[model samples]
Target chain A: MNPLDKPYAQLALAVLAVLVLPLFLKSGILATEILIFAMVVAACNLLLGYTGLLSFGQGIFFGIGTYAAGICLTRWQIPVPVVLASAAVLGAATATLVGWLSIRRQGVYFVMLTLAFSQLFYFVAYTFSGVTGGDNGLLGVPRPSVGGTALNAPWSYYTYVAVCFVAVFAILVMVTQSTFGRTLLAIRENEGRAAAIGFPTKLFKLEAFAISGAVTAFGGALHAMLIGVAPLSNIEYHTSELILIMTIIGGSSSLFGSVLGAGFYLLLADALSTVWPRWLLLLGLVLVTVALFLQRGLWGLVERGYDLVFRRERAPETPAEEH
Target chain B: MTDIALQTRGLGVKYGNFHALAEVDLQIRRNSVHSIIGPNGACKTTLFHALTGRVRASSGRIELDGRDITDTSDDDRVRLGIARSFQVTSLFPNLALRENLRLAAQGRTPWQALAPWRRAEANAEALAIADEVIERLALAPVSNRLAGELSHGQQRRLEVGMAMAARPRVILLDEPTSGMGIDDIEAMKQLIRDLGRDHTVLFIEHNMGIVMNISDMVTVMRLGRKLVEGPPAQVRDDPEVQRAYLGNMITGDIA
Candidate 1:
């Protein structure tokens, strides 16, 4: 059996990545962002990879979390734990509503519904300047203090985000190993058969959405703290696209693939943006290459490497049967 | 009557102006192998769809153990003891054969199906049912293989096994032997014969030999209506059934 198939092995890799990022990168802030996005992207994978729902409304939950953190921290100075919890709850509530409405349709129509919801949310945040601070966003968000000392340094705050990242990653891993996760995969494979076998597939899909929304929101709140501001861009359509792109580039087959995708995209952007202003064009070329050659993303490459090194023989592919 | 495991009255399904099935009445007896047979486009599959709630009936009602379940959702119908396999094989192609069976076994308990904290392997009851199904279907050799990797015969048997995993009182199998060789057909025939001992098995088939050999009762259909229904020997001998369906096939097989 592949070592990566084990949950403990995957978790250990996550811990290793968290420990190693600081050693290679000079910017603690960028390292923290990779961890935050990793959690959010993995949440997206629960829908896209496991449940086969290509949701575009993940940014809605993520943005809601940012606003939750922004409003609570800037105005009320609520405890960090409470603020984080509220962000997750609000994200879940919003996701439930969106998932319920969007899942009423399937295929392209479902994708359209989520995209429309993303736009609607963006406008709501934009129009409600009184609460969301309109274009300026809600600024002056403070990082949580540990004991009596404030995590004023970027590296100190990276430690805080790293702990949350591990917890969230483990929870997501647990969910995928559970019966619910297996059912989600079943639904992804054949929903009609699942329903015939007596599984309420729609409810399961909605529950996946809820979990994805909660995790994405938690990541959003962390991002707000990482930057010390909840920007309006956090809720935009572009944010949804970026998260989806990372999910695709990393591969959806495994949870760790999500981390690889987030890290790869961010690190690539950081490197290219400094050297060339036309970095997006280069990114487009990368996307095409991934789509054409690396369909399973970076994780597929890693799996191929592992197979070559250890097994020296290709795993047998399941022969397709004609209908 | 309690002897009737499943019953449908005045069942009809319409798509726009076309009537796929009309005025179809069926009474499937308890613990009998009931087979529905017809020529192509005879609405045989349409009847199974209406019975299993895959397609809405424009008129009339369906009952399970004499209880009205005309408005029940498709998934709820499975919980209410009606499970069905598709005309086209529809197992979860990406999942292992064991996991596919386990999902079906776990379907009866929806609350536990949503247990996110507990591992899927922890559901001992479901695991046991899956293992029993694998053994019963003689799929133990390839239990760990992906469903998509199975041959047409194995997939067909797996299709029936998945429905059986639900432990449903009424099992509806659509074309359980649509595409099988001689040996596969023999195995499936014996499997269906055994299934009738415990389950009220309703199946659709084109294999006249297997149908006549195993079915306790048979319903012949033609162009969205029931042509005739009786014990296999009686149905085969009926002039209307011979003219509409059985024709030379029945005589060819018996002779």
Candidate 2:
């Protein structure tokens, strides 16, 4: 069976992640950030890990989703649910267009295409000072409410995010482990072979990118709703790279790794910001060190350990010299 | 008389000044094991690629089941009941053997694209199909084993099995017996012989003994052109084949 057959388990984990993390986190704000960022990592993993396409424009969609929601409640007076939905659709639509163009090329060209398009979004945002507020960004974005009940408390908002994460995580897990996922894996293993097998290889990859973009955007929109504004700095190429680093460094094997990576990275960054105050330098140092030392990342190492233990257990049980 | 399965007319493929395949003409029949043999750079793989839609033929049209398929992509070819196995083993190395065969059997479709969602039923079917294929290939023990961990010969059989799962009307095997030792070659030859039941097979083999024993017809090539085509017995007796291979054998250590 596709590993994602257990949608309930994955959903439970997503919920458990949000609910349980508060035990360790000193502040409700920190807990919410950690959960949302974990979502960002999982979305990145869908592209980089399973599909074998490393996209660098995820933040563009994330930031765009944030801006869409921000602009909706503040400028257009749209309902919070309507704003979130519109933002998600916008993020997915933009990603589809970018992915359609980007998936055509292979190797370095794919990476360059995503990076170039992401920068294009940044420039567009920077140039359109009217709607986007240029660098200043929109303020007083509305909070999600159900029947005049404001979901404004940290736990309330965190629960909302938790529910959304659970759904997205379940959907992504299904996408990753399904027959469609197998096609993506085939593409990753060998693009030429996958094409020869009669796959519309590029299109499948593009769809993955689009979905991945949508998820990232969902997280970003939620983050903006929680924080009150969407800044251009939040969706730049650097932000995309940070998500990539988190996914790869934490492990791209399972969606579980994604959550772990996001939490650890955010925690590290939070610790650095408190002490030295120059957080970016601390993050850069950590990313470089992890990249240099652990090419497989943290989850990769854990998987290796798991495999070693299992192999040892199975070794003596073989009935005969197996073929 | 057997009808033509694949026919190419006035086909020319060139990379720069070099003619990889130069205006070659050939007719391959249905239900026959048609083997292409030649010296290095004889354009066997290039021809296979063009036939299976890997490389675009600079000039000429390809016909499948007497229908034009010149512009069809490889996946479309598979849907049209044409399939191919690579010279090298290609599969999801992490997944079990059954999953690989299931994907092949499923082919590539929108339903299959949504496969990850239908986990319970799709996976069970994939596993069942994998087990059937494994049992058919006498690889039942390796049903749960990782594809990357399988032996070279097992991998070869699995590759062929993957193609078989596509349920192709015609199967193309590129150098199926390329790197096998003597024993492995014989096993591979039997595997191919068993596979001859359902579909027409087109393959290339460097080792003449295996080619002579298995192929119903032979297409000989030299320097990007079809040197000759005939029954194995007649092609074996041809003076041109003797001269081409003999010339290389005496001059080249392979003789």
Best by lDDT: 1
Q: Which ten residues in a row have the lowest lDDT in candidate 1 chain B?
A: B246-255
lDDT of 1 at A252: 87
lDDT of 2 by residue, B81-135 (tens): 7888888777778776776777777663434664447553465654566567778
Model 2 stretches astray by more than 4 angstroms:
A1-12, A301-323, B108-111, B114-116, B120-129, B246-255
Model 1 misplaced stretches (Cα beyond 4 Å)? A313-323, B252-255
Per-residue C-alpha lDDT of model 2 across residues A46-150, encoded as one tens digit per residue: 888888888998889888888888777787778776777787788889889989989888889989999999899999998998988888988777678867898
Clashing pairs in 1: none
Tens-place lDDT per residue, model 1, A1-323, is 57776889889989999999999999999999999999999999999999999999989999999999999999999999999999999999999999999999999999999999999999999999999999999999999999988787999999999999999999999999999999999999999899889998889999999999999999999999999999999999999999999999999889999999999999999999999999999999999999999998888898888888988776776653332
Model 1 chain A: lowest-lDDT 10 consecutive positions: A314-323
What interface RMSD does each of the candidate structures achieve? 3.4, 2.8
User: Where does the lowest 10-residue lDDT sum fall in candidate 2 chain A?
Assistant: A314-323
